[model samples]
Target: MAPLMRNRSPNNVPNELNVEYYRQRASAGLIISEATAITEQGQGYSNVPGIYTDEAVEGWQNVTRAVHEAGGKIFCQLQHVGRISHKSLQPFGDPPVAPSAIQAKAKSFVVYSDGTSDFIETSLPRHLKPFEISGIIEDYRRAAARTLEAGFDGVEIHAANGYLIDQFLRSSSNQRTDLYGGPLENRARFMFDIVGCISREIGPGRTAIRLSPVAPSNDVHDERPQALYNYIASQLSAYDLAYVHIVEGATGGDRTYQQGPEPFDYAEMRETYYRTDGSGAWMVNNGYDRPLAIEALEKERADLICFGRPFIANPDLVRRLRINAPLNALDQRTLFGGDAKGYTDYPVLGG
Candidate 1:
């Protein structure tokens, strides 16, 4: 559900609201938790949760316990918004880090330096040090371990929406002469290394990745997305991940203007992954309603379909879709920071 930015605590601890929220929607077979930061440095927006602290771990454990008790499976999405941040969001007023010092030609949700929380233009970031890069990888490793400890079924590494990993994969964001940048293979090396490390640290079957090949989100773009993702999927085939979730077109935006003018073929990408020995579930997201989801499933376009907006107001979304029931419109005003008015008051069927 988009509009999940409920910055309730400085430490970003999950509370009763979180547990109740997930529990109410437990009917959704696989409930992927919202994107969470791995470390304080990974935080981008205010009030989002993290898995790096004792309070965070304890809080998410409560959420997991609730979901599991309700007979639901959930995965925690680990995300690090690279240059998609501002000084007010970073620790000690440090600039956000990226593969290159280039500022994203995009805006981010941030607490302005003047002390107001709002969506503003992203600030320029400094290049990460070689050692800092390794440190970030270690953070990811620890984050995965923490998620497992908190009793999550698995984790989906966030590599979409112009986040940390996406910046590295797209040449428009990464203009470095080092091994971590330049050619597509080099640009993609960081993701493989992180995925390989996490999979090894936390078992491949329990790890997954979310990617947006041609979305160009967060001011990131590639000259050849088809070749880029073909290589990525083909290379990913070596790992035994649970699945690969792709954001078709863009992440949480206009569905009509999808994949840009030249969209990469999902069929070709799937073929490449399978052809290269990739063995995992394939998931597609973005602009899916019940009818489209059913069609995609029937046509075998995807193994799983993720619905974002629908879940915001429909706790019994799975049942609603199954029976073709009407959905409730989301209250846009209560989307970001709010109490339980629109957050948890949305009625289920017959509620």
Candidate 2:
């Protein structure tokens, strides 16, 4: 599994709590925690962690402490789901808001009162105004502040995977005609603003951003991804933040639409952020292995690698890599929005 960081899970776990899980895999140069909702309104799935609560701050503090004790650095990934959420997942049963009123074609995975599973299609999003947009930025800033309070090394703004930020980044999903949409710069303005706010809250050195330029998951489509992302990279460089994480393959779902006579070259897309200013670090995720990770690092394509499923089954992933041990296969059945069955039940190597 490449980009080893999995999506968010419930903050509370058994013996393998957030602290233990992170400490176990502390050998990784950087451990990006699962997607953390910026606010209750930002949450798309039930039981996922939130950075906005006092209890969550304490829980993540334990996680950061454990990773630090094991000599590892950790980054908190901030996620905000806009139209991709159901009323059940929203705050006070409020409808999820987005840049436009468009409803995402995707369904959100949620748990019922009976503990059964179901998928609910997204409802019409409340088209946000300029003032509401400012509130969203504040939400991100507050989450960043809480992350700092939790003792994380840094924060990664989740602007990919068809979430709230991705909705604004993609032209097809974002039909706004205001300064917050339309052109690439305007489309990217919200992200940049968020970066600025978070930087102010936690400092630029401890800030990072994740972007999926070519991956069209969540019905996100842009006429010119290369141009749009190039512009984004160029703009992001001015901030001199921590790093930029890019998801290279088809994120969220299978690839169905054909680009052209040739498939999108991930290497070329990698160059956009890697060469933007040469100041910030670059991380490449999605379907990467040991050899490819080392190659990307050696070729300077990516400074750090993220592994998702591999870490799920092998907590001692760094040690396994050092000893060339085989990794346990991930159980897809228990992947998303589940309990301890696959969350932390995987035994450590030789344990």
Give all TM-scores, in the order shown. Answer: 0.94, 0.91
The 10-residue segment with the lowest total lDDT in model 1: 1-10
lDDT value for candidate 1?
A: 0.84
Which lDDT tens digits does candidate 2 get at residues 47-90? 67788878888888888888888888899989898888888787
lDDT of 1 by residue, 106-129 (tens): 876654345556778888899998
RMSD of 1: 2.2
lDDT values, one for every candidate = 0.84, 0.77
Which TM-score value belongs to model 2? 0.91
Candidate 2 pairs with clashing backbones: 3-306, 3-307, 3-308, 4-306, 4-307, 4-308
